[model samples]
Target: MRLPFPSLSTLPPTLAKPPRYFPTLISHTSTTTTPYYRPLSRSLSHPSQPHHPQANHSTTPPPPSSKMSSPAPAQYVTVTPTPSGYALLTIHRNPVNSMNTLLWSQLQAALDRCEQDPNIRGLILTSGLSRPVFTAGNDLTEIFAPMTSREQYARFWTVSNQFLARLYRSPLITAAAIHGACPAGGTAMSMACDHRSISLHPASSMGLNEVAIGIPVPAKWAQLMATLTGQGEANRLCGFGKMVDAAEAKRIGLVDSLVDGEGKEVVADAVRWMEKTLRLPDVGRVITKAHFRDRLSREWEDEEWLRSEAEGAWEMLASDEVVTVLGGVMQRMSGKAKI
Candidate 1:
């Protein structure tokens, strides 16, 4: 029996246009026989496919793109300050704000700016993408690309985890105004915040369901989830990679509050909440937050260890098992799109 798939004219919003951050591959053929081979857009020569262990031999993937050494975009995130003594840092890598090295660096910079500036008392994280998504997740291309070197993956991991560590431990009051479908990295960032105020829109949900994508959630992520929802619930949720709606999230402590509308209304509610919180004496809040969250944050502190972990990430993504699983997933989606 033929599986149901989207007609060519009716592609999903995510598949309609290629993601800018993860432009590691571009379709070069429509033939069903193209196999699961992914030709790296940057180094098409590699024409990489997972070296299935069952095969007698396979080609080694090439090094990362030369463009990696080039300067990244000056503004990958935008900082918009409000009169409410809070600033909104909109992840500006649009189409889908998949956190890559550039986004991580830019986000770190934006956070630094907000904290250093006397005018900004707190900061909120949101998305600049018009779509109802905070972020799809970390750009998987770094792992999936044929030209992805271990070093490159290491850099990507280090930069992103560092930013996340900082976000978790930020001195300024932090909040995530989750406006849409948040998964994986999006949920991690939201968890990093002091409060998660989410939109009640049906399109909005949150989860650490990286298992669905064949990704391993870092231990720290699960630890933080446990901190919020308790060890039993965190184990159940992360173990299954389940996504939860706003109501369930609020009830489970995955989210602190829910706003009635999406977009500006939700952000406004978060700002209002932040304003009220800012009224409290600042140092007490900061230190108290540190007391509870410091241990988890400290796990990501060592740059060297993170780099070593990145090698493991490279192995996981490029492994025979992950490649086969993710390949099947991509094939189904692309096949659906082509139909």
Candidate 2:
């Protein structure tokens, strides 16, 4: 079904009102500092002016320069507008586009902007790098770090859940153009999209590899997997953490279609389908999709998947075996440890 795009210039008057504020009571002090009420008046007097605060004897010490000068985190995901009114978001982080915390946050922000933009009718999610790997999944280095805390892990998982959930529920149609290895969280990402077009390269691997990392499939991942390949398939895939080749993925319906050769044509074909299907008069496609998937997502939301992720992260961090195994994998790959 075709969804009408909202005009930005014609937004309702209610949205143009002054920013709302919540009232808070502040404790009074005898210190000779400018009162908050006076600052409010000054702000009203010169709405467009900037004010620099002067330090007083009783004022708190300024935070270190390093803190003030810290740069905003870099955006790992790149969004490019296409002529087809759809955008392509490429996860460009090198050999394996592992979804680190920074990448996850960036992805959410990109999706948010795309969803709000009237010109963007749909989106094609893919990696920037060529095949042999689309994404190897979450950054094992971050996941297996010694200093990683349960709270941090939980926050990471929560972020991932929110990002994936939004993609699944986006008002615009979404498609995943996968070329190479997409394991663990990567596979979950493809499944979250409305359609997945994969390349049939021998090197391409796809599956849920969470068990290998010693974590049970969280509710969101499990639900998406189940949606793509039934409960039985999802159970086996998650339980075994098996990585399937491209051919096996298509055979089992894990992937919607396999692109010939290197899969460069996959995105073009997906774009064609999106253009045709998105124009359908009936909005049932989008409505039905949301109806079916929202039920499962709600179950996940109720379970508090973020909290579970944090707990799992804490447990994984506390495990010397997990740390040793991950370190050994990295060292062996680098020729610093015996295989």
Candidate 3:
């Protein structure tokens, strides 16, 4: 059944309050800083897919085989069909689910498989296990790899942008269940989804802190952040590169709500929410979602903008300053450098 667009009168009291802006928590010389909270418009199941809820999933682990994308290693991603006709894509990379070219390809493959399956009504995107850190963002080692040419850097940015476009334009309802630290690219992935929820914990922080690490948030990404938080706020968070806790994230509208539990509980909560959203007629939900989001998707069609974004992304990766900062971070994470 189709429902009318929600109005102010229909919103809950907690949401009706005026948006409260928070001061900049992180400072970046080139970055800029807002307080406007907009009601985030936010969506499940499939059968016949492997791991279908009805399937007597093998007690024995399955062999590694490419099931999703053409040639990408699919080991990093898993797709299971829910009884409700939704697909659950679990991001599982050891240590941390850092985004690499392979992970990106695998993720896109999982998305492609679920989107192509008519039985799948929606998608729940989340990490594999309950970890303190959902994903530390991109694999900085790969991102800061010794680049011989701009084309190499461009390829990396292109892969990232392409996958992001898929997430942004997916016809199926998508939700992100974030439980731990979601920064930079992780933040972008969640924002691309139709709805997002984060676990309530002091360690749980989320934001597009790309600039803090020397990467420029692309135009489309920038617009997505702006859509949730005002333009100035987007710049402040992304440019200054700061991570905000779950409470602040919810208050700023970065997340729709703060989940009470951690790990699988958080995933279940998000899945339940998506399942509820799926009760609405798919036709209306899909159309209305597109109506609100297609404007930003169309921005990718601009050839000039794409070229500029690619060039700028490459420039950031190639900059001596950016490389040094990235290298430093990696060293710290690896315990090669001390505070």
What lDDT tens digits, residue by residue, belong to model 1 across residues 115-134? Answer: 54555678888887788888
lDDT of 3 by residue, 89-169 (tens): 888877778877767777765665565455676888888855666766777755674533576655656666667776786
Q: Candidate 1: where is the Cα deviation over 4 Å?
A: 1-74, 145-147, 332-339
Q: Across residues 160-207, which tens digit of lDDT does each residue of candidate 2 receive?
A: 777787677665679888887888888888888878888777778889
* TM, every model: 0.75, 0.75, 0.74
Model 3, residue pairs in steric clash: 45-84, 45-85, 45-86, 46-85, 46-86
What is residue 215's positional error in candidate 3, in angstroms? Answer: 3.2
TM-score of 3: 0.74
Between candidates 1 and 3, name the one with more favorable lDDT. Answer: 1
Ranking by lDDT: 1, 3, 2
